[model samples]
Target: MTLKSFSGVALAALAVTFLSAASAQANDISKCVLSGEKGSVAITPVNEGAITVETALPNPAWWNGDTPDQIADGYEYCLAANIAHRAGFDKVNLVVSSFPALIANANQNKDLAMATISITDERKKVLSFSAPYFSSDIGVMVKAGTKVDAETVKTFRIGVLQGTTGAKFVSERIKPAEEKVYAENPAMFAALMAGQIDAAITDTAIILGQAAKSNGALTVAAQYQTGEFYGAIYPKESPNKEAMDKIIDDMRADGTLAKLASTYLADSWGADPTKVPYLKP
Candidate 1:
């Protein structure tokens, strides 16, 4: 064959070899797959591996680009994808479910679960967690025209995720007229937008992204420093915990995690972590 033709053929062959290897890896992941709860859906993974990691939404499915049976593009999702890719996992599965559901089925047929889930003493009993990849203060969302000074938030109808740090903060500190628990990020934000709730408390990134996306319809009324960090969840006694923890440690040492944070979150996403303005009623 001609030299140029030979080169082209070689490149094509290399591409085919890569595809074949990738296909083989996917089959490997499927071979080891465990059956998940009824709601979970298989995803076309960025990498192929022996175990399937499951995920709910990024809370804000809008920000994360998560849909049923599709891999999400949110920062948390990206973080999981990166870690799995780094750890030599060839495939991952995505599901859009509430945290309650995700937590309920943690190890049924899934290897890992993520959705900006915070590491907590309570959660440790049921699920193992990798080292922290992200830390943030909680933020409260409110309408653009509302007054949120130190005291005005009490007049605002407030809500938080059912079992989150934000919920703890609201229950113990805010003690609203009637504390509302939302199922997911979008629902909380929707309540705020529709005037159903005057405010919703969530992670800093959610506040930041919502405020930016709302076009002056929503604003971050307040931020509370909860000293919280996000971690990916694994089944209790997960075999991958040690390797995943080491991978996170190495990523931190190499600045991979910070780079990811900046790429996904603004540079100053959580600049302050000590603002406590909630008042117990």
Candidate 2:
């Protein structure tokens, strides 16, 4: 080949190499399996395992022949579907891990956390939080006839999701007679249903979701005034923080967030649509 032709080919190869390196750098999030639409954020599952909001079956089917796929059509499942849609993503992978691990993994991998992570001053020190996706108060879940009231349940054995605001609130505000820390909300709720604990403490929204699925097998004793809100978590130094924040702000301003909460969380948790918490710059 002539020298001119060879030089042109070499330049094309160099450009290709540079583009590939930039793309790899852009997608460097460890363990983040990017699928579905653009800007999709992943959530860690509750406890059982990964359940896709887009295609998973409902959990509370009344029919004996109902498969897991059939039950995925419940409101809670649709709520997750709504969250993904409002967040501008068609899908979000759920990673099942403890709250601490979720935070740690998000930080270490430089991936955004779509877990049902509550925003608190303590967590703010280590991570940036998107707008309040769901508002929930701490509450106690107990059997149908359990002798527990909001005020009196402080002395009962309470199960809490480990490393969550619910756990922190129980430890600081309401000292339970005994504390059982589970890695995820579902496990804590399961423990309550199984009669292994007197009560389970968690976000009202989550407990309500479980109660809805269990067909009134559980009841909320009382909602506490923790004033907690769940948000999408990101590394403290994430460049996408500004973009994520802007998306949340837009959602809040445009009534998208309220609509999502009302559809998924309002009936069960009484989440106020007007009570979105503002994030700091």
Candidate 3:
């Protein structure tokens, strides 16, 4: 072959290789992005390779296990895993973080945290919330054979989880004769069963699940229509908020969220939250 022809063929091969690599890179970027209200945004992992997801643990049905690695089951775990996958991360780095700590500290450094956090205007001041993934209402649970209602609850010893809407409700609206704040669900439930607290108030799904596991030792007394929705929380003004919101919306639209709820929550919650009687609080 002539020297000129050989040079032309070599250059053509080099151009083809460059175009192929560029196309592959473009496809990869497309896979890494999520588009929503703001526009397309790329999800960058907060941790090295895996997406960091913080959750309050030992929450039966929602987060069944006690530690980070053991939290391989339940609704929130399943949802978190799905979120990581959609974000183009191969795995999720689950970390144990308290519910209050996550809310109070705006610079927690985690990519996302899910602790059944209710989206409230007051909380939005310090944190950015992804679009709501689940909704719940205020619930009242009492020891078996104990009687309590909206009005009567004002006189009972009430137990609430600190830094939660339940605590806010009891303090602001209920004005109960006595109120106790516990850091976590197990502690609060222990106080109720031991008679240290006359009743416990929190999200309907949570108390109902606890009550179901109690096997007649406890019962849900009343529920209020607070119309609260749970969202995945992000650090204040985090750039990834829009991307996570878009991912959640897509999951909802494609019925992925529904499937996860059905698989993990159906048996764990044990009772239908919608059927719980609503009381005026």
Winning candidate number (lDDT): 3
Worst 10 residues of 3 by lDDT: 27-36
How well is each residue in 153-211 modelled by candidate 3, as lDDT tens digits?
Answer: 88999999989988998899888999999998899999998999999999886888899
Per-residue CA lDDT of candidate 1, range 1-281, in tens? 34334222221122222122322122223222111121122322323553455665654422355564454444565555555555555455664567778767544556577777777787777777778766645777788767776566666678788777778877787666666788777787787788788788877656777677677777676677555667777765566677667766665554445444544454223222223243323
The residue-by-residue lDDT of candidate 2 on 238-280, one tens digit each, is 5556655665555444443443344334454343322322211
TM-score of 3: 0.82
Better of 1 and 2 by lDDT: 1
Per-candidate TM equals 0.73, 0.62, 0.82
Alpha-carbon RMSD of each model? 13.2, 16.7, 15.7
lDDT of each: 0.58, 0.51, 0.72
- Pairs in clash, predicted candidate 2: 44-95, 45-95, 57-69, 57-71, 57-72, 58-71, 58-72
lDDT at residue 221 of model 3 (Cα atoms): 75
lDDT of 3 at 128: 80
Off by over 4 Å in 2: 1-96, 106-111, 267-281
